[model samples]
Target chain A: MQPNGQLSRFGAMKVALHRLAFVVLVAAAFGLMLLGKADTVLVTRLSHAVTDALAPVLEVMSKPAASVGAVMNNIRELAAIREENARLREENQRLLRWQTLARQLQVENQRLRDLANLVPDPRPRSITGRVVADTGGVFARSLLVTVGARDGARKGQVVVAAEGLVGRLTEVGARSSRVLLLTDINSKIPVVMEESRARAILVGDNSNRPELAFLKAKAGVSPGDRIVTSGVTGAFPPGLPVGVVASVDEGHIRVELFIEEGRLELVRILDYGPDGIIADPGPGAAARAGTD
Target chain B: MRPTLWQTLDQTARRLIPFGLSLLLLLLAIVPMTTPGFLRAGPMITLLCVYYWAVHRPDMMGYLGGFSLGLLEDILMNTPLGVSSLILMLTQMVVLTQYRFFVGRPFLITWWALALVALGAILLKALAIALLSGYVVAPGPLIASYVLTLLLYPILAWVFARTQILLTKEP
Candidate 1:
């Protein structure tokens, strides 16, 4: 081959390589997007792995920053003490009423607990974790908590806050796990409308309010209706408060989550598995079983 | 006169500046992911950085480089995969076409133009996501983010320029 022809051929090869690289990168980006939508498992794993690897460095860096932020917040609060005082006064009255209701509910809850214990499987092991980071970027909604497989934080474990359902643990590492926020576009929870018991799919759209999909038009759902996990998918337990209906538009309803994303500082990871509920004994089964 | 070895080294370093800056910008773009409500505003910081580099260093920050950085941002930020890449490539094209006008402009004017570009990039990204996903697109959050990015532009631009100057100084 002539020298010029060989040089030109090499140039063509270089261009081909560049084009191939571009194709691969674009394909990778598309795969990631699809992955982001299809399931939370991969994201959860990536998040836990990344954060676990980076946590020590982040801890060292964020400590001083957090302390500085706290100091600034304190200063701001001091400046607005009068306004805060008034708000607190109003809140205290509300708390008093809640306290009264809480006591009554606690007693009733104890009675129900006793009844449930008599049935079986009264105790379920649970672990508590603090939300160390809510670092899932705009397209991905996830929270990194300080509990992982080492702490019995298994995949698909339901995470709840003091208020209500937070999300399910999608991935777990040795000492950390990723909680796919209910608002992630990839998140879909089988939920039932509290008032009409209408079954619908709660789909996240990377927004504060998740859209209710596949809801029956005649479901008679209205604004302010509560939503809870139906446990139909055998992932989350039934009857956990998920969110409340914020707005109902044509063919889509939005939920105002009970657990605020910004304020999720701590959560309890339930140890319950797919077989959450134990079957109750049939009528006369107790006596028959005793004889056996 | 023929370029000296020192001149060649300086030129190489000058070209390398944008690449390093883009990485840092990509990291900053992902910072909002750590905080709630940060990502909804669009990839503002990223748009700004890409615009700046495309204007200042088009030779280095070409189509493929811009696209790759956008893709990396998407992976790190966990957004729709091609969303940032599409926006970035478009922004790079726009900035590259108008590179000459921005090269010698005053810092404030440069910042203002960047703010405008950031706003446009974000709006386009939001519209694309909405159309693709068939999701209920709220204009409110996008608007809020645009305003915030505009307000943040001068500070970020200043920091970026300072870093470039500090790093590329002739020893």
Candidate 2:
């Protein structure tokens, strides 16, 4: 109502519509759920098309959230300058000592390599993309990256963040790809516990910490051990950083992922060739993989 | 006096504000909240937004509008297509059935009713996820989100009220 008690010419929708249409829509929703199971290929195609079509809208929309995050981070950093300075000072001293040790080890490694005439694995090609959207709610843990077949992005490519291996490109479209994060139910990565070199499958159960499956009995695994891809399945490169063992309760070992999904903004998709099979070969390729 | 075609279209667009604003909130829901503990349970803005319209201006956000909004959310959020549509339409229909009771009630009573409806809706969502994805989500996050979404209702309703006034004011 206005000052004169006059209603706006456009605002009086004071009644609900007919009930038949509501019933039809609800039934259609039911049909959609059934359709997914009956025809997964069709459902997958439709979802991909929808994601590809909305990629630009998501890209444009995400910029504002990122800007807000940056601003807030700046304020937070300003507030904790003194504390951060103290922490950095101590970290610098520790890193300086590790730097010396690393140099010595590198020299010894080089000498050994020269003596054995060892070969090194060539680097894989990679493309970086911005994360546009991720599955909402607790239903799924996949990300829509703003790169696709048009940009040379392909399915099965390993996606990594600055810290380490994040996930893999499971679905690729013309303008976007769905990265199935390491925390999804369907994801399983062949990994090795670095301390003991025991192999296992890193399985996700839609939780923050994915668990280790098929681990060898009495494998000497403990808390704080590193986990890396073993490259056994011919899908991922060996020795890529994955995570650290977070716990070992009753033979269940969970890994704390290196990449926090909240902080993940950019991801690099690496094509390690169609075959991850490491074998004896000539000057261009073979089993001489070395971590830099 | 006969209104022109443009005037009629303008009137229709103005009435579509509730649906449009709810769609915008739906998009914002998918944007990962930097806030801890809230990431897993996104703010269920669409639920309350649709409820608000279904109670106050049901003619604007009819079945078609609710269906389209839910379908878009499904497509964008990577849920089984139509799950959201079913949930939203059902929510709207439920609210419409109780329209008379909520028509002139105080904000608190309407909010109290929302808590009940939202709890049911969240449980349904969990069931859908479990059935579709085979992962039983922890109940803690779902309950936490239910409370948070209810807490956010007053603020969203206040904004919708203002917009409704603007839309209905004599031009």
Q: Pick by TM-score: which candidate is best?
A: 2
Query: What DockQ results for candidate 1?
Result: 0.22
lDDT of each: 0.70, 0.80
Predicted model with the maximum lDDT = 2
Model 2 DockQ, alpha carbons vs. true complex: 0.56
In candidate 2, what are the lDDT values of residues B98-167, reduced to their tens digit?
Answer: 7788898888999999999998888898798678766787776677678888988998999999988888
Instruction: For candidate 1, state the interface root-mean-square deviation in angstroms to 1 decimal.
Output: 4.7
lDDT of 1 by residue, A1-292 (tens): 6999999999999767755755665566566557666766775566456567644443444445456656776998999999999999999999999999999999998898676544333245689986655544344677667787878888888889988998888767888777888988779989988777788889987678889998875358778899998866656666789999898777578899998776566689988643453334566447434432
Winner by DockQ:
2
Q: What share of the true interface contacts does each candidate keep?
A: 0.13, 0.58
